[model samples]
Target chain A: MTASKPISLKDEGLEQKKRSTPMGDALRQFRRNKMAVVAFFIITFFIFMAVTASLWSNISFLDAPKGFKARHTINPAGLDRVDPYAEPGHCARDGLDQGKAWCALLTEEQRARFPNSCRVEIPDPNQRQWCYILGSDGGGKDWMTQTVYGAQVSLAVAFVGSSVSLLLGLVYGMVSGFYGGRIDNVMMRFVDFLYGIPGLVIIIIMQVYFREISSKYEDSSGIVGFIVEINKDLGGLFFLFIALGLLSWIGTARLARGQVLSYREKEFVEAARAVGARDRRIIFVHLLPNIIGPLLVAETLAIPGYIFAEAFLSYIGLGVQPGTPSWGEMISRAGQEGGFYSNRHMIYVPSAALVMLTLAFNFFGDGLRDALDPRLRGR
Target chain B: MTNVAKSEKVMTAPAKKKDYGDPIVSVRGLKKHFPIKSGLIFQRETAAVKAVDGLDFDIFRGETLGLVGESGCGKSTTGRTILQLHRATSGTVNFEGTELTTLKGNSLREMRRKMQIIFQDPYASLNPRMSISRIISEPLVVHGIGSERDRQKRVEELLERVGLNPFFANRYPHEFSGGQRQRIGVARALALEPSFIVCDEPISALDVSIQAQVVNLLQDLQRDMGLTYLFIAHDLSMVRHICDRVAVMYLGKIVEMAESEELYTNPLHPYTQALLSAVPVPDPDVEENRQRIILKGDLPSPANPPVGCNFNTRCPVAIDVCFDWDPELIEVLPGHWVACHRVT
Candidate 1:
């Protein structure tokens, strides 16, 4: 007898099923886009790195060491006596031989200036200063630990700032687009006025105002009492984020406003209105969902810009003071040694990290932008 | 003067014969004029766009009343105003026994449950992002009816009733063809089991073949569900086929109203006579025999309609009386209404 294929599922009894939830359909569609999935993974990796900074960093970055003395400190007298280019204890190594070799390169006048150098140097074994894995700066602090720890603070500011800006922009844009007319005019005019000001000037003003307040609190109370009363801990970072976000969100507000204006004219909005859905429901539920894709893309693209700004500010000594380890501080150190060119490692390491982080955000943001675009779907 | 009196006598000598029960909807002296503001900051009302200048009609129970007009004739505006979609500047829209214009909040929504509208573009009428089931279930959800399972079952029934496969309920509007999408729109409108529907040129955007199917489906639904309709279209041929009574509109006012067959067979008003003569008869010989009454000039702007009869500027048979005083809508025959000084 000929072998017969078993009855198929469709033929057996089951009927085709249809999706009941629109949310499920949208989520399924979102998952099918490979670039969006990759972006999701990349974002998750950065978030993981940010949250686990303590485990990654060699030093406890959160705790600022106030009284710890350096194991090695160069004395001013020693600076004059010792040859700057010679290795540690090289002055006493075979006294005349190595010292003469170092001196041979010098002119007769330079040798006369260092008359007592040969007797002044004392031979010492194992006299090397502490070396970090990524090597120490001129101040003998590990850059590897500092940079890893710094990522947390810089990333936090960018995320928090973008989030704050997104929230404010959404509210302002939605209200303006929904109410329209005079309310829209008044709100948009304020946004336009804010946009007219120089961004850096606003940032500087905010930083100075915050600094003055903190200083006033410090002066009113002792440092310990001030820490208790003013309570500037991570709270300070949050406040800074809020300040940056509030000052920098005009662009996002305008973009969101334009989106809402177009979205409000769509047939779905009219249908919602005709159905007697409240103004709030129509604005928030009907119109907002349609514009969320653009907003999300805008927010992702904004993160790297904010990150670069924060790093640039820190490089100029205007951001994340001395105690906080930042990529900008690492870069500043390299440049301080007469333009970080002599020690290329110092410059490239932090600069490379910053470039990598910014590019990762941009690449992922581009992926999200493509995935979120309604026109790019199904293919 | 003697000939005018003789014509008036001829107009209303016939006794009343048709009465399709009492009217479920009635509008009287409805007027909506929107002012034209100029000069921005030093704004002033320059003029007014009389969107629905003055309209009076009665939609009888268990009947489809077709309102036919060209674009800008305020047919859609009249429907919207009657439905209270636009807060009328001044009008009385009495539905059943209650007034619609004065009702607010829950009462108005309750009124909406009894009456609904199917829009021109099927693609736009239903929310594209919402699933077919969700789109159909919206009115039910908004009105707070039944449990989720019961609502789902009802949605499926409505889908089947409108001749759509129930399995397609999960699909977004974009997934369906234009005809299927229109069926989904019909299903959504039928979900509430409303007594009256404003078919606002529902099939105007569809294929000619699909238009007939939709019109037939609407008629079948009307018969099966005992639903009434205010069918608005610019197509006179379709109006004659589907409507029990037809009203012809020009500019912002109804110029003539009569039984569909009678209106097609004999149009009294000059504009109506011209419009009916323009529709080509399917029989070529008869079409050749007919005299086409083509009028001069384009439709007058609703913002600045003629001072007298709205159609006076374009009417081929317009007289001196047509340009002096605005004619009022009045019944000339037992059931037919017309607004023209010459007709009286």
Candidate 2:
């Protein structure tokens, strides 16, 4: 009998069929990856929160209303005459009863909920009736309002700071990697110099310098009520964004530079250069597209960095000023007198927000890294 | 014998008959020395690695000049320096009579369009993140060749020419095997339709059986497209198979140059003879009859090569003159140039 060869059973239907285009295939694979899908949702959730956080609560929750008209102006002495425990209707006029009446006017839930909370009149001509949701700070500004405003400030800062850092790092790294040799050496040396400096100390020094410059601008020649003008004209959101972004780009630049160094030597880059391509074209068209995957992952990881920085700075009282509603500020305010042990919600809410933000960003970053990886894209 | 000398004279005479043509690329007095640095805080340049030391050669039009050498003999460095991939410490590379060393920016890039290089390792050569189509079409896009449709068609054609399914144009480099990826690399090199290519050990990383296929493909492409190649390799047998003329390099200098058939049949340089003797013939009977010359000691450091002849330290037939005065490459016969005191 003739020796017989065994028929292979390894043939699958997918092997016989022509595969779709790589871009389409990559999209399909990305969709199939459950972790990546979940991460996409998480990223979407954070972005939605960041964009529409004010809409979820009162728009003015973090700010004093610009144009509020009061029904009556109360004398400060009159605030002392009111009985603390008297029934709402039996209260005497122009006494502590007014404060109690104002407190009682709040929903029954609020009355039973925050006992220390009370309404205060900002005798300032601009603001009228101000109710403290979590009570006032040492400056008698509404802590709840400040905390809400602080969210706007802190979140804006994180986003802006992270973006700036990402841009700077990507540019620096790509330049270093593309040119290499002496150029790489010089740029890397500068990076090392920056890295050697203590980050917190640098931030402190920068803040002190900027703060002085700002105060100078505020105090120069009494030009149309400066501090009040700046407080009104300069949104805390803008300051936070610019500050965090400027301080944060070095890390991203280092990552980009390393990736570019390896990538520039690859055959594809040589191919492009061989075609009489300009250096700019080779860098942007050939090199940059390959690096975007890593950059995306790096930027995503950097969001948490931005958040933590904002929280740390705010905790140390350099983050947000009074009358801003920031999660970090809320946590800071709550931590005073160890309120964390009693009013657990005060600590948990902002803490949970920060945690969720960081976790979401990390998940998205990991997903993006995998998605961008060429090896992972195929199968 | 008097008869042997006459035979040597006869062998070298007709070998010079090959046309030198208008030399397409000429590299003169090329030197690339990588500095060896010391000290922690302030790095001091202690010495230099003579990667490509005082090399001179010319590539005539439409000829595959095989650069055969041992590892670290500066074959690859020579290729890179010729392409200006490494800025030469001091050298002049003239491409189509244009002084390449002095050309900067746009002019240099314009010159590069006429020449390209294929790397050794297929795995690392192509970008892992880029699609085959992108990789192939990148040259076209960079040079502003055509619109999207024309570029697409060109990429597909190049892919097909390299024996890959044109449909795989969109696939990433990692999706392909070593051979297939090498084909993709070849396709990328062909995209710009350059006249000259530096085949930098193109098939060294491939399987032995697959190596022949790639070599054949390169030969076929060269014949059909009239492409000139500087095929650099450590494999002597493969170089013999593809090269028209072969230059064997030692350290950073060309030790011997002759037609492939002439070099194989009658090697003048001792190093060349030793190298040819080391190749394993396929037939068992011939292999048994061959005398393998096993040279002692590892190759000396390129940073500090031995004085006089670089190969004298390893030469099987080294005379006192081999150690006293370093030999210059001079035509022993009309065609064959050997840098050995014995040969001249």
TM-score of chain B of each: 0.93, 0.93
TM-score: model 2 vs. ground truth: 0.79
* lDDT by residue for model 1 (B261-297), tens: 8788878889898888888889989988989988899
Q: All predictions: root-mean-square deviation over Cα? A: 9.9, 8.4
Reference-based TM-score of each model: 0.80, 0.79
C-alpha-based local distance difference test score of model 1: 0.72
For residues A1-379, what per-residue lDDT tens digits would candidate 1 score against the true structure?
A: 0001222335423245454244554455667766656656766776686666556442321112221111222222233322322221223212333444566677788777655433335455236232244544555344555666667766787788788888888888878877876678778889988988888777767766766666567556665446524335542454457558876677778778898898777655665556666676776666777777788778888888888877777788666655566677668867886434555666766787788777777766776666667566556
- Clashing pairs for predicted structure model 1, backbone only: none
Q: Write the per-residue lDDT of candidate 2 for residues B1-344, one digit (tens) a residue.
A: 34223333443334475765766887777789999987644668999999888766677789889999899999999998888877899868889989988887878877777888898899887766578888788878777789999999999888778776776777676656787788888888888888999999999999997787788788878988899999999899899889889999999988998888889999999999989999999999999999988888888899999988899899988999888877877778776878898888
Clashes of each: 0, 21
Compose the digit string of candidate 2's lDDT tens values, residues A5-101: 1112232123464455545565776677677778678657655654564453342222242211111122333344322222212223333345456
The DockQ of predicted model 2 stands at 0.26
Q: Where does model 2 exceed 4 Å of error? A: A1-43, A58-151, A181-183, A208-216, A219-243, A375-379, B1-23, B35-46, B90-108, B288-290
Residue B26 displacement (Å), model 2:
3.8
lDDT of each: 0.72, 0.71
